[model samples]
Target: MKLKVDYKKCEKAGECYYNHNALFERTDNGFPKILVEDLTTDALRHEAAEAIEVCPTGAITIEE
Candidate 1:
């Protein structure tokens, strides 16, 4: 699975990083930075999904 982020739609809410710090990180400017681009495990996939759901702007998407 691949994770895609729509920067234009992002609000810099930091919810993604708060929910799943292992998969997402915060940049110096307070935007989200994907720590794991490719979801290779079940745990990672689930975590990514949670991050997507938690994102207020719906900026994150999963590509399978």
Candidate 2:
């Protein structure tokens, strides 16, 4: 699986970073930066899905 972000649609809510710091990081301006690209492990896939769901702007997407 792959994780993608729509930067234009991102609201910088920080939910993904807050919930999954290992997979996502917050920029100085508070935007979410993806720490990992391809989710090769099951754990990462699950976490990515959770982040996508928590994102209020629906900016995060999972490509399977």
TM-score each candidate.
0.93, 0.93
Model 1 TM-score is 0.93
Model 2 per-residue lDDT tens digits across residues 1-64: 8898899999999999999887899999988889998999989998898998899999999887
> Can you tell me which runs of candidate 2 are displaced by over 4 Å?
none
Candidate 1 stretches greater than 4 Å from native = none
Provide the overall lDDT of each model, using Cα atoms, as 2-decimal numbers.
0.90, 0.91
Candidate 2: Cα lDDT at 63: 82
Q: Give the clashing pairs for model 2.
A: none
Poorest lDDT segment (10 consecutive residues) of candidate 1: 16-25
